[model samples]
Target: SAKHSDLCERRNIYADEKSSLESELDKNLVQRKNELEMTLIDARIMESETLVENESFDLELIDKRIASFRQLLEEKDAKIDELVKQQTDQKELLDKLRAAEDKQMDIINVEAKTSRKIAIKLETIEKKHNECLRKLSKMGTIPSDCDNNYHNMSLKDEYLELQKCKHKLSKMPSVNQKALDQLTEGREKGRILQLEKREIKAGYESIQRLIETLEHQKYEKIQVTYKSVSKFFVEIFQRLVPEGKAFIDMVYKDSADSGSAGSQASGSHASQESQSSGGISGAGLTPTFAQIDNFIGVRIRVAFTGKTVVKEMNQLSGGQKSIVALAFIFAIQRCDPPPFYLFDEVDQALDPFYRKALADLIKEMSRSSQFISTTFRPELLGSAQKFFGVKFAKRVMILENICVKLISDCNMN
Candidate 1:
């Protein structure tokens, strides 16, 4: 019995242990089922949120597409409206053009009818004129044998003037037919002579006035030119020679006025002399032309170095004279600048310093005018833009760059 009791106790203990283990396993299975259900719930919620977001984005995109389509429709509607307006304007213009065409047709028809009536009236007038001419011819009273009136008919003013003259002549004093005939020839001749004399006198007066006008213009031009050239002369001379200045002194025999008494007297004297001598070509007039028609003359005055007083041409040295001559040429050129200039050793007589000044002057002047200079000085050659030397052999020209050929070619020429 003790054995049996011990065995029962053990079995009971085992049964308790089995029941505890089964309870622990049931708790674990319940916890695991709850975790799985939570996981499935989370996944389902995420999928639903994702689907809602996607639908929202798709709806927004669809709304944007619809807005774009609506905008395109609006643009098309505006274009259609503009086209409709243009069509309406074109139709109105077409209607106006048709109305103008009808009005023009009416005016053309009226003008055509008026032209036909004028043509008929002209024909009737021509027939009456022919009949009048025939009757006048039969009576031997027609002033002109040829009775052509077509040209006169077109010239209403001339025809009216002829009619007035005829009326006046008819009202004049009567005279013996034979005496009137004799006086008519003399009167016509006298009238013609008188007209010729009047014409000659008028022509002479016109020519005299023209000559006076031309002389006045020439005087003014000379005064202006002299002033310009003189100013340039002084400037150029001073520039070429730092301590020198030059000027052109103008000497006039009279007041330099075309209407001056001295001028008139001189002109009259010249005319009388020319006539008396038969021709000015054969006259013993000086070939110098230093008189300038006895109107004016020019004298060059220059001063160099310590000489402050202006000296005449004979007073200057050779170098000073060359400088003065170059200055004069440049002065005249400035007044009427040419396209180009040709100078042959213009600085030959100039000192080294003056030669440099001449080169600078040429360079400055070349800004406005081109210069071609044959120069021996290195000072001028330095300022040259292009240097070319010429050689002549058998009349053939050979060009080289700044060499002895320069002098040789010039000697040949």
Candidate 2:
């Protein structure tokens, strides 16, 4: 029984050891399960964070695209505004063109009416001139006959008066003293009648010369009047264009091809002189229609040295034409001087040296006339006695900067 009890105790000890080993195994298993569960929860949290990150990145991209689209819309709106402005400008230009066309048409109609009126007036003048010529011819013929008849009658009357004086002397001879007195009276009467006849002859000759002189003077006056008008045009044309030649042609009635034919005839005599001296004195004379028989026509020629040959006024460059036109206007002003002159952009085409020369010329001219010019160049400003600059938001300001610089320089000196 003691051996059985010892065996039982050993058995109990082994069973207890086994039970503790099982409990430790179960605890390790529980711990491992709890660790797996915690790892799974951590993995889920990481997946959720990654998803949130992707969503935020997508939202940022969408915001950028919207901003780009808004910029494109603004650009398109700006282009539309520019196009609208161009369309409005084109409409205004079209309106102006239509108005100009209408004005040109009105000018054409007025010119046509004026031409018709001039034609009618010319016809009337021609008719009146012909009637006057007819009347003059008739008067000339009648006056010549009347003068001859008057001369014959004066001679007959003188002869009758001499015979009457002789008869009176014979009757007075009965009284010797009376006869002598009568003879002396008759001699004195004869001398007086001779003197009267001589005076009458002289009066007739003087009257004829006076008529001839009056007709010659009338012809000369007409020629001079026409010449004066032509000279005026020539002077005007000369002033209008620098280094240009101009002339006027006078008209006459007697010849059909008078201008060319007469010029050729005069040229034959004029060829002895140089062409630079111009044509013969009378070579320019030409006959035209009755109305404009005394009228004068003008011709002008301009020579440009450099660049392409410009045959017409329109062919010249803007600056060149302006200069030429200004020269002409200045020449006109010289004919009738003005109180002063104002010039703007007048030296646009001139170079520095030429500009200086022009300023000097202006200064020289200013002795007789006052001149004012506006310019942006420093060289041009130097020409002025007093310089004023137009400043933004400020009234005409005298250029004090230059003066300040000059004073500083003087102080340094």
Candidate 3:
């Protein structure tokens, strides 16, 4: 009971403290509201003073901003008008483009119709061509195949391809029909040219054979004549120069075992043609039978005492050359047996011994051939059967007979 009474007393005390704190909080709240009202009143007074001081400047700035905004709006209006004009022009151009495209489409439709007609005709022709191929296969004109897929080709694709080919062909140069028309004539001319070439080839072969035969005959003839003449030549030279030997040498360009005349000639006709052309640039200058050293030439080799040395005519002594020349003349005469010979001072450069030998040779050869000599040598003059001397006149020569015999021969030596 006592604890309860004390608790009531503390509660009354706490209640009294709470009432005092609540009253103090209310008073503080009222003071804060009054201070806020005073601050609002002071701010309103400052704001009114600021508006009064800067009102003219603010109004001028607002007017300037309005003017700038109006200028920008006018510029934007001009730009909008230019854009609208461009848009109208573009609309008109689009309409014209659409009309031109429509016209082009109509022309394309017409061309497509024509192409379709052509395609129909080509299809008919292709059918006929296939039928003809079938017939040809049956007739054994061509081999038949079961899988001829080419016949099933799309007409549209083929027509498109043909159009492309035609376009390409049109872009190229025109056909030269005139040159094509001359094809038959050209073929005929070509045939004639071929025939002519064959004929020329045949003729060349014939000529080559003929030349071989002639060369062989000439070689044989020279060989036989050289043999006969060498016999006489050695005998004559021995009589002139004791212990002397002489002979004629023959050289051949080709081998002795050349092919027979019956064989086909392996020699080229091109070489013959080149020879006929006679190029000076040495372009076709290959070695031939004629180009060999001393080919078909008769060279005389002679030695007065020992084995014969083959020397050129320029290398021999004058008298020795003269003897050789005379020997050759005599040899030739013996072979052909000429009816007469007219010699002009043939012993002019001969040595005394050779001169006598020449005179003796003339006397010996005189039996077979008549020797007419014009000489200044006493030995040859004494050997003459008939003598005629020339006495010079002003404009003429007088012929007088001289004694044919030497004085020592007529009497005693």
Candidate 4:
């Protein structure tokens, strides 16, 4: 029994051990199985992700292809639109071309009608030319039949016949005597007109002669008047230059009626003292109107020292001439007093003594007429009734009648 119990206990322990081993083995197998299942699940998940990535990639490729197709479609649509615009333009051009072709056809038709009319006109012109050529040919055949001498004789005979008929008509009596009388009166009127024309020509010649005579008379009068004025000038000139004599000379431009050309007239006068010395003398007689003509164009000659010259009166020295002119003017004024007299710078050339004399003369002349003079010399101040001082400041002071007054000034005070 003890052996049997030991055997049972060993069997029990073995069984228990077997059972525990089996359990451990089973748990390990279950864990390995679960791990294998998880590995399979991960592989499935990786495969599903790869499939999804491939689907997304395919979708992206399809989208790219769709975009490319859309672009191509847009290009095609643009090409179609361009083609449609070109077709519309081509239609419009074709319509204009048709209209132009129709207009050209109308022009061509009109040109054809014009060409036909021109052809008809050419035919008519050719017919007329042919007729003219035939007429010219006929004329050419009939030209040289009559001799020149015979033709001239025939013309002379006709002229003689006409003259004989005219003679007969002139010799025949008029049907009405009144008509003959009228013809005679007409001839008398023509004769009178001819006489009047001759009279008019004679009158024109007479008028021309009269004009020439009048011009000659005017020249003579001028010469005579100039001689008188020259005589007065000579007296003044001689007084100016005590050493020489002066005379005025007349010059003529053309021939006088007496047929003398380039003639000159001169009248000379000298002082009494100069004449007594025989250095200068007058011709001893006054010239008549006829003798004055001989001296009408004489030139004045002035001799100073040994030199003889012809010079204008204005060429004389101012002071010398002024004295002479003043003397002459005083003489004239003494003879006939003027209503008023003005002396401008008359004392400019006078010496003190002459100035005094001139002042006295002016005062004497003032009794008959008004005398005004301007002087800068202090000696002349005593002779003035009033004194006026002109200042550089544009002021004028009048000391006239010893009542000093300001004539003009900028400042009132």
Candidate 5:
């Protein structure tokens, strides 16, 4: 009986322990499920927050870009407006220039016509003067104007003036005996005055003739000098540049005023003249002495290379311009050479060929004239007979004659 009781009690204890263990496991599973749910909800909230923050950042960046683009567009528009205003101003300036050009043309035409008329009158006066001189020469010994020196008178003019004076004095009251004597004295003085007037007129005419003669002589001298200088320029240019052709030409104020360019201007005088006249077809308004008449300015025409078109001195390179100037000096020296020419680094801008040519030319002409030149060119050194150098000692610069061998050494130092 005691053993049965102990067995029942043990069975009851095992049932309670199994039930309690099952309840504990069910509570743990429920708690674990609640924690998982809470964690998933927190993760979703964090994801949504991150998405909202990302969107806000993107919107701010886009707004900034749009503002920058708007500013850039405004700047471009302002630039465009400024350009348009400049263009308008340029157009207005061009129109004003055109109007001024037309006015200048009309004035030039009027002046040209006046010049022609004056020339015709001069010719007529010259003929009359010659005839009068021939008649007077055949008549007696030439009267000396020194006896009665008067200025600016004519015999015919004096007679007319005397008549007018007599008419004015005729209305005066009758004169007394003393007044008669005074009138007689006045008449004698008038006769002497007429003789003086004749002498003065003759003297004035002689002076006029002398002026005309001198003017002709001046024109001839100008022509001769131009020809000689032009010839020398051609020779020197040929020596310097065998293939290059260059020339000096007179640039007329009228041609520039007319705003005309020569038609078909090449390396010839005829072409240059046509260009100077602006190829005016109908009026033939070109002057015969247009090139030589006005001594306004001179221009240089050159082609540095054989194949290039001829250009003005203003169009040449710095080196080429220096070469041209050197050639001009050579021409002047050959024309009216001085005792000695002082040159300061004359070969600085010269090319090798030009330097050699210049040295050779100088050596050739050295016998006629002396050249005191300063140069670093070996060509000039080879041709030189004397050299000079400067020494700096104790802050003092001293000039001394240096030997040919020492020149290079001093330069190196």
Candidate 6:
């Protein structure tokens, strides 16, 4: 009951204080409203002052955060400095490493060379050891009695025997290691050469046969042409010269060597040829064209009735030689007739009778061949189917007046 009274007394005291505080707060609120009327932003100024205080506190916090960030930046800068130093150290180390590698390579090369020399020396020693073992093996086991006998020999005698054996061994010839291989290679080369020789021989034989065949054909052509020319020459010469003997002789080196013997034979044959037709030394040329290369020439042998021996072309008169020339030309034409014959003043050296004979021959051949002759002789004019005359009216010689046959037909087409 006392504690309850104490609580009520305390509540009455708190109520009185609250009432006084409420009245005081109302009075303050009215004063603040009046102050706001007097200075419209006074409360805002007060709130701004508090806000400025809170902002100052926030600035302190930002300053602390800035200080922390600066420490962090300084730490990162130090780390960058440390990393740059490490990179510099690594670069220097890499240079040292490369230098060391080059030095090591030089050392390794030297060692490799030394090892190779040692290996070669070792191989030589091993070969010598193997050779000694092989020789000892070949010697086999010595008999006990022989061993005893060797043991009894003096040291000087054994040394002398060793020297003698060494001298004999030095005299032994060295074996050729490649003899079998060389022999095989030589045999193979020999076989290949033999095959090449056979092929060459076969090619040579084939070429030789081909040359022979060509030579035979060339000989046939020469003989056929010579036979026809010679036959016509005899008959034509008889017509041109009533009592003259003429023959075309192939002057081979062999016939020239026979001299007068060949001349006498050819002379007798020409005499008989006037009756019939045959010329001595009329055989075909040598089958080999190479022999034709050895040939001298064709000689014209003519014998007038007054002359006993056949005369060469050089012995005839100008007119007689001209006649023989005409005969020769006619003979060749009869044998292998050409499409045209061009005679430039051939009748100029001929006698009137010979010229007349030549004109007749031309007229006869005119049926098959065209003859263009330049001659002052009327005999050639008589045989002409067409004629062109030169007029010297101007300084230049102009061809004018086409005359077919006679001069009377100068305007003839």
Best by TM-score: 6
lDDT of 3: 0.69
Better of 3 and 4 by TM-score: 3
In terms of lDDT, model 2 sits at 0.60
Please give the lDDT score for candidate 1: 0.73
lDDT of model 1, residue 14: 99
Q: Which order, best to worst by lDDT? A: 6, 5, 1, 3, 4, 2
TM-score of 5: 0.49
Query: At residue 93, what lDDT does model 4 achieve?
Result: 100
lDDT tens digits by residue: candidate 5, 250-300: 556675565535522433544334234432211223224435556665566
TM-score of 6: 0.51
Clash total of candidate 4: 10
Worst 10-residue lDDT window for candidate 1 reads: 278-287
Tens digits of lDDT, candidate 2, 217-304: 7667655544554454334434433334433334334333365556545533433231233411234443323335344442222344
Q: Candidate 4: where is the Cα deviation over 4 Å?
A: 1-246, 253-315, 324-338, 353-369, 378-413
Model 6 lDDT per residue over 95-179, tens place:
9999999999999999999999999999999999999888765544434586776788999998797688668756864845346
Scanning candidate 4 in windows of ten residues, the lowest lDDT window is: 403-412
Per-candidate TM vs. native? 0.43, 0.29, 0.41, 0.33, 0.49, 0.51
Error of 1 at 138 (Å): 26
lDDT of 6: 0.77
Worst 10 residues of 3 by lDDT: 262-271
> Over the stretch 1-413, how does candidate 4's per-residue lDDT look in tens digits?
99999999999999999999899879998889899999999999999999999999999999999999999999999999999999999999999999999999999999999999999999999999999888655433322544553465777786696588557757865545245546778999999999999999999999999987886787677655554555554554444444555543343333244332222232323323223432222343333455544554543444433244433345656654566567556544544458988777788987776666566656655677887766766445555555555435447554433322432221123
**TM-score, cand. 3 vs. native:** 0.41
Instruction: For each of the candidates, give the backbone clash count.
Output: 0, 1, 0, 10, 1, 0
Instruction: Give the alpha-carbon lDDT of every model.
Output: 0.73, 0.60, 0.69, 0.62, 0.74, 0.77
